[model samples]
Target chain A: MKRSSISSFSNPAVIAELAAHLHRNNVASIHIEAADGELKLVAPVGASLQTTHRATPVLISASQPGSLLAKAPTAGIFAAAHPLRPEREISTGSAVAKGDIVAFVKVGPVLVPVIAEKAGKVVSVTSETGTLVGYGTSLFTAKT
Target chain B: MIHVLGCGPLNTIQDLGRAGYRNIGVTATGAMDPIALKVGNLLVGNDEDAAGIEIQTFPFRIEFEQAQVFALTGADCAARLDGQDLPPWWCIRAEPGQVLELSTPMKSARAYLCLQGGIDVPLVMGSRSTSLRGSFGGHEGRPLAVGDILPVMAGTTISPPVNGFGIVPPAQAMPNLFPVSDTGDLILRAIPAGEHDLFGDDSERFWSQTWKITSQSDRTGYRLSGAPLQLSAPVELRSYGIIPGIVQVPPGGEPIIQMSDANTAGGYPKMAGVIDGDLWRLGQARIGSKISFRQSSLTEALAVERAIDAYIDDIRRTLPLVANALVAMTKR
Candidate 1:
């Protein structure tokens, strides 16, 4: 559902400021859903994002056949790869084994690995690196 | 419990080290790279000063006799668990009977293997570190040998996600502070010691020339081979109390930098004392590695110490937050 009325009033600078605050504090992402509209801001993961925050309402759809959505196990900053091993980052089209560490959710100084639920090819990475994410946030869409 | 299936000589159990006993003629024998041990312990939910296995000689191999959590830090020894490659500075859980092996490292010289709750060695003189010189602490007062079964203390368990996680090594995380020389020599910061003036013009050579760590080096001290640092004249000085990091010049004129297992007293002339903050880098320096000294002031030394303290403080403050958060998250 498109809320054109509320979308017209969202200020770009306000969103940028919020995103900057999240990055400065090492937070992953924030989501606010109200009766009028929804505002979601995520920090960049691997590389710096050209656009700091995403304010547009996301489209929610049913899972397609053979597709599996890997959700975040807890809330924290999402990392595409371990901080020390960036070259092994999991990306779209990367083949992953069941129980493989496709990414990480960093809480403070500790990094909690984000595991692959099943062996599959990553169809898409829904979460951006360095962005704040909440528990159960869909991080990757993969095809088994 | 873990059984040492294979190990090299000199690999020993060490903690932060024994303090206040150097007066009684006991060397503060401990991990050469103490920072690595502390970080490894912190990663495994152990106290910063917890005892761990400091593995220098390799290929060291061990088998987990029981399920346990462990963290590997310091030198990247290309460790593997049941043939699965693990990154350096990583923490993970191992199932019973899982074999963990470490190969000779290509870069850094020592690797610390810290288990959850630390190694259950009897604390001798207020620490669990082995006093190899005195042969009184750690596992039977000697280095770890094959078939040595070390008991790990019971610790509060926290769940880590499958495949585990790792942190950026301090060398990479805190770069550009005390940088390496452009010529690829390890740069060590030092404060002029008592006998520094005696070297006269030779003191300049000590600072300018890159010294190679000779084969005679060990935990006690690194005998550097470079231009002879002859003093203005021969002067006999009485033997006095000494500690690690003191740069002493003996009759041979080559400088010797004291280390973890340094003798309690020495009679040689002192040139410069390496700053404590940079000692870990020196600890990991391999034999044949080139190193040069950069003169530093007390203010600069304190500043560097503060930066290292901040790094450790960050880990101490944030580890509990992460553990608690993970426990709550897993419960859901």
Candidate 2:
């Protein structure tokens, strides 16, 4: 098939020069393969704006269809460990059983333990330590 | 009963001063800071006027002869129970063998350790307070010494083990309670006494200048260093009854404020009287520290007294709730 859009740039020298310019600008892919083909270019999003879509859900794991997301049980300051034992932190891949204190939330001077709901390996810690978190905010992702 | 392992030279057992006895000749030798004694008593669930140990020296050591619930108030003495640090103004349970060591206070001049009940010394003249001059009451009318074992009152109720709370001293809880000087001098509120006019210009100077607390001050009286206050003339005055807080300017240029152990009567020209509410600040005043006078009224003094009462009432009301809450939390 032939078209005027691609035909206008039919010269091999002009086409090569256009491709070189696009490549220098870090464009990922370009298509002008056919005489009638519309020119198209794609570039990876900048690192600062890597994830621009809000509706894209994060998958905890590919192998597990129902990977567990550990959420805050109550609204308070999310602490990775007890306030008294601040040096201790919940490590990723650490095994936790049901009712085990995987993390804590500090309410004033009192520490409230966040118990695990199911036996699992911590896939990732989602909440930053000492940050105020609301109820149901993701604290960790675990694979049971 | 508790055994004194070590104590400062001035440590003694005290309660609220002996009431209705100044008519005789007995000085009401009691805790310099009566509010501290009262608060410590309340923390441990005792009568506000319960006799307790008043520690003025550093490294005061005591061993519990029996399991008891006790509270420490007043100064932050850096207390340690068997090497573990104890919070000031806190109530804690002590096992029979636990030794509590109270070092010199970091910010105050005295500390009060009160047991669950009042001290069990024989009440003389209807009070358990020590009469240092009469040598009649409170652990044989002498300061507590090593090897001196004080028996706590029998059947004194032991508070719950979970009871743990502290109170900020009234003077510290509100900055406005006792006005502090810019130079850090403790400015005590005083009411001009009967002889205040006798000093004339010196009276004005007394209210304006900062007076240094001299080393000669003791429980009986605080000798102050300032301009020599002179009477309008050398007048012979009859010996009259005096109470704590009376500022007596004696021979020479210094002023003297009577304390908990002061003589019941005096003949010195009294320029002012430190109000009952602010005497505790003078109690905590260390030697070499400076003090200023703030002229106050009786109505204002009564208000400060009410404020202190309200503070104690708050602690009394909130402590049980806190204890119950702590117990519930621990069980979960």
Candidate 3:
């Protein structure tokens, strides 16, 4: 099998053309190697190959290096503190331990706590109070 | 199962109180604040009227014998579990042998503790409330004491981890709908009762003057001290059915407002009855707290009841969805 190299096709238009060809040929998945990077595309179930990229699926491991992003455990309105109490809002740079309630997601009258899964120092809070957040969306970032 | 390590003032098991037995002279004998009890039970996925602990004193403590879910409602007693503070009205799970302690309430007088199913107690006269007078129901018909062991209703099915959710307590000492006096006394809405007109000039003073809850008050009745309220003339009457919130005046001229554990029937002249909607406010009223009464139309009284019902309806509709969502999230 001849290896396909996409180093010469630095323009995005060329990549789009190649993706269109793969779609026409009914290819489900394909990997292209470039001079500085690689692109991998897998067609979604019951669909043809795409021309644009979807969200990059991230695999989070506790041992992963650098800053760790804390994501929403569920979908709801994010609350930096207790809903009835605005003064208890969690601030940036606070120390958090495993299973500590750092924030909440309010659904109706119920507040689901966004607990820390590992001990770390909070670096930033990305979600605003009362803002809607989807599951796995980055809510905050912390350094272990 | 749970063990009572210490009880500060008074702790009694209460539900919505017994009904129908009043015809035979049985007091309802339930929670001083039924709204608190109902909200606490609903938070733990229990029936709204399920039995729970009504803590009247402060610094109460209990230890869970097994891991279970529970909720605290009513007064903000500043509760802590295993040394970590819990927000009032939040439902949290307890690990085995974890101690839950309650300090003096900051806002209201009573606090309720509701378990997932409820506090397991045999119903007496259709309720699990403790009848202090009758002494026949609720943990041997008396207040919970130290070293007492209470059984919790067994969980029917494993529920989702409902660890963080809470609602605002419905009991407000000062609600905006009613008038509040300059002295910060709560103004409870009232309607004319059977002998309302018999009080003559006293009726006018009842609505105008602020009354202080005397130290003699308890679950049975609140002895109010203010301007003396006397009847137009001495009248003899047979004992009649009396419910909670009925304002009765004895010869001493001091008006007494009936409570949850009030006598089923009384011979005192009933001057006015507090509206059902404002009864919860009375329940949260502490000794020395002052209150004034407002003459409200029956229509207005009905409106207050409707608002309370609607608030409860909102909770009933939303709590189940919250519970389900929690379960689904945990499964993931």
DockQ, ranked from best to worst: 1, 3, 2
Instruction: Looking at model 2, give its docking quality level.
Output: incorrect
Q: Candidate 2 regions off by >4 Å?
A: A1-144, B154-163
lDDT of 3 by residue, A16-107 (tens): 45545655676755555455434443333334323333433332223433365466655456778764455767667788877777787655
Docking class of 1: incorrect
TM-score of chain A of each: 0.56, 0.50, 0.52
lDDT per residue as tens, model 1, A1-144: 244433331332334455567767766666665555444555544323444443222333345334664666555667888655678889888998887778877654556678778899888887677666655566887887
Candidate with the greatest DockQ versus the true structure: 1
Off by over 4 Å in 1: A1-94, A121-144
For A62-133, candidate 2 gives per-residue lDDT tens digits of 343235546554334567863333455676878877755577553332234565678888887866775654
Rank by lDDT, descending? 1, 3, 2
TM-score comparison, 2 vs 3, better candidate: 3
True contacts kept of 1: 0.40
Q: Report the lDDT tens digits of candidate 2 across residue range B172-203.
A: 45568878888777889999998889887888
User: What TM-score would you give candidate 1 relative to the actual structure?
Assistant: 0.82
Candidate 1, B1-332: lDDT as tens digits: 99999999999999988988889888887889888988898888888899999999999999999989999999989899998878788888999999999999988899999999889989998999888888989999999999999999998555444577666677765886767987878999999999999899999999999999999999999999988989998889998889889999999999999999999988999999999999999889999999999999899999989988888877776665556544433432
lDDT scores of the candidates, listed in order: 0.81, 0.73, 0.76
lDDT of 3 by residue, B272-328 (tens): 999988898899899999898998898998877877777677677666665654553
